[model samples]
Target: MSSQFELLTTRRFLPFFLTQALGAFNDNIFKNSLMLLMAFTAASNLPMSTDILMNLAAGLFILPFFLFSASAGELADNMEKSRIIRWVKLAEILLMSFAAIAFYYELYMVLLGLLFLMGTQSAFFGPVKYAILPSLVNEEELIGANALVEMGTFVAILLGTIGAGLLMGLEQTLFAVSCVLVGTSIAGYLSARKVPAVPMENEAKPYKWQPVRQTKQAMRICFEQRPIYLSILAISWFWFLGAGYLTQFPNFAKNSLGGDSSVVTVLLCAFTIGVAVGSMLCERLSGHKIELGIVPIGSIGLTVFGIDLYFATPANVGDQILAAGAFFEQAYAWRVLIDLSLIGIFGGFFIVPLYALLQQRAKPQERARVISANNIFNALFMVGSAFSGIVLLGVMELSIPEYFLVLAVFNAVVAVYVYSQMPEFVLRFVIWMLGHSMYRVTHEDLNNIPDEGAALIVCNHVSYVDAMLLAGACRRPIRFVMDEGIFKNPALGWLFKLAKTIPICAKAKNEETFENAFKQIKAELDDGNVVCIFPEGKLTRSGDINPFKKGVERILEETPVPVVPMAIQGLWGSFFSHHGSGIFKSGKRFWSKVKIVASEPVAATSANAEMLQDKVQQLRGEYQ
Candidate 1:
């Protein structure tokens, strides 16, 4: 049977997607039109000069992120998100109004003012725009939603950039620009109106005038979660690295590919599509959790492809390269396109999860504040990216692909450092690798697994490979509550520890170990992590099954959330089950496979010792 992608079909995503796409298109259209006007036509006609005005326009646009982003984030939290978006869109309309007037009257200063106002609108809208997703999307849908947003934005920008370039290059560029702005503004306003209202989370927080002071306080609170800080740094640094490449790609195409702006467009398209593909696939790749393994893989791609592009590229393929169309004919040029596209693809895989992770994991009360803090770092990195680009390409005179090589190596080095410090990323990486390498397993009704706030997985005891199989199928990384003896097995010890597996023993089995194990599992689930335990507490030596223990209920009394019953199927004779030697003493390294049947989720109330065992036995009936 085919699956309908529910996330993409939802109303919550569609309206916002269109609104953002229109806004991006509008921004690029006007910005590109203005660039053409000032660079060629306006400059030629001006009595004094146009470069100063152009520079002022650029500064005006970016300045709002620094001034208004913090306030915007707070506003989104304090008021309805959809309403705030509407107001932001209204402001965009007003900004475009001013632009229309400026274009008609030839008022350059007025145009610059509109640009500044545009920046202001974007600033206030930025935080709410990204931070609102966790509330709107299911945890599993985050990756898909984010990917769509990004992809749509890029598509709009690409189209707008091309449209603006063509129309603005005409003799009556201002009128063409004015027409584009008016249409885009109209489209934006209509889309914003269609957006459904989502109520504010923070209803009572005081809104005061001390923006700087409040921002600092918010930043202080956000960094309290160290992993959050690391994530911020990683994300910010990506923008920094990406900004250089983005800014330079046009020049790189012109200089190396011996092509014009059309090649630049192709490069942009490839990269954008790559990101779109990457972002959309993130939901599937990471299995709906924030899998940091992809970050390493992305980093590696950034470095490796970057280096390859440098070597594969021959300098000055032609002294005077023809238009962009001819470059495609060269097989060598295709490499650059593929490289950029993959870089973007990997970049999406790296970024989307981290963004979702921040939203889902950050304290709900301070979510907007954390988002604002992220904005601060983002602004810093983007600004820094401008300088980095200049330093690497201009001052150092490094070739374009060589810059790519440098960025790639830098990504690898930084990734290693980040993963080493917080081993969760590396741990997830190991799990990701193992799961992919293991037999293909289709996980359905995984929502049959709880999202958070404590959960115990009760599964029938099958074989040595039961936990591994179950862990692979689960969306969340489960802390397997296992017997100490099995945990201490030399062969799988590393895997267990990496999974953060907690080992428990019965008082009769090992008192100190049991107490320690209970304490650890209790703490883990209490903090809203998934904990899995086999009620049998050991592999069934008998071909049938083993009796249940009250240990599950005992743990639930301390940290109760949801108990999910999982059934291991088809493991009876797959080399590890009791069908042959029937014990761990047998040294049979056998390649075999089986299916895991995940039963419907059970509440802690229904998970008494007897009921839980009966439920699993039923699910495991024929397979076991």
Candidate 2:
């Protein structure tokens, strides 16, 4: 649990974290300060209303992501990342110094231009921000690293927003805001200088300035991997939902909650703090692994609380608007705050792993470009969220609560479509639930299995859920060879199929099915996959090791891959095991302590059925 925090004490991660967090903080401070200025003092003198000016400002900030992300990606990939961070932070310092002048003179137009420059700086930083994590940390630490970054980002956003309000409240608003923005920029640049350089693996290519052509090339690189592309889309959708909620908060607070600006701040705090909490929780919840299982859990919480928020809203406002303290005194207000907070918390769960996965899975050479494409999509989705809010709350005449309900329903639709396209998410969720709920699973020596390349795992058969338990324990995805009867079990068929488990039968029963199963096993191994087989072929009714079958020997003869022997203990009497009258006939035990142990891998030539069985039996020992 403390592993994620330990990263902050090290030179590799801490400086980078501070650099990024400060960057986010500065962006929000400047943006929010400008918005506050327009809404309060500059509104009367502006050619357009405050609302239009605010929207225009938002567009100007995000426009750089659309126009310059491709070029940014190219630069990040071609140059050293730490140098890029330093340069970007230096640009921020220069821009913020200009911003100080703009603030001092109340030069609103210059401030707007500075905002665009700030966005441009961020656009360049985006790719390097995420792409550098893998180079800085180990594979196991990637999730924890991402969790901290996500948490820091939301916290910075919250503080920056609040800081803007505080600065604007001062008598010397211009001096205070200018000093704070410029000071933060300088601090950010100093931190960026401490970030260690991460050199590109391949030779640097020539930089191209064509945004349209480079963007298309980046998108092509993004789409080259289905999982990475889907991850990008999912991340983009989260931004859409986030943008929708954030854009409507002030109006919703004013019209529905009957509250002043302070109440809007409260809502913002609840949501932002929730995200920070949730993000930090990801490392612990995932056991420091990039666990995709919790993603669905996050999505479920998001939709559930999103709909609850709509229900929690008051039907009408009182004659007098309430202050923050008065709003908290109301029962429904608490419900609304809790709903927003939980939505933010779940949002943390939803997003951290996807980013980690994108970093872990993308081709190292193209990683920055893939992240750049993700940035473009995020900007587009956020802009779409603004328009969707206009149409739903304005043209369609839907109340804010009604609009929230719409967003919740749409989230469900998007989640279903995304999961359907990539059943891997749902599959991981199922495995994750089993470990967290049904069993308190512990693993020993799982590192005996190779991190990559082909391998075979042989374990004792103990329960109907052994395959799942094994899948949950191992880091890499495994292709399990299961008895056809269990594979076709009506209750767990979909899970088995989703896992791509190969179904086999005794040759005497079905020669073709048996032969095909071997073919599939060989194919999976040939493709560098981990394949696990319960060599005993059936569950143990007597809580003892069953005799190993010859099928394992046959598969090994063909594939000749490394064979890792494993053992499962303490599951014999569980509901899914055959320790009772039959399967599913015994009293169910919740949170049963289960242990899986793996032995060193044996060469294919030395891995016979009897020898592997002896190794598994030795590992199991007296645990059963």
Which candidate achieves the best lDDT against the true structure?
Answer: 2
Root-mean-square deviation (CA) per prediction: 3.5, 1.3
Candidate 2 residue-wise lDDT at 2: 55
Candidate 1: misplaced stretches above 4 Å?
A: 1-10, 45-57, 204-206, 287-293, 461-469, 485-492, 505-510, 525-529, 539-550, 553-562, 570-594, 600-611
Query: What TM-score, over all chains together, does every model reach?
Result: 0.89, 0.98
- Model 2 alpha-carbon miss at residue 521, Å: 1.7
Candidate 2 deviation (Cα RMSD): 1.3
Cα lDDT tens digits, model 1, 480-598, are 88878778878777767777788878898679988898899888887888888898988886546688898888887877678888777666655556665644446433544456676
* Candidate 1 local Cα displacement, residue 564, angstroms: 2.9
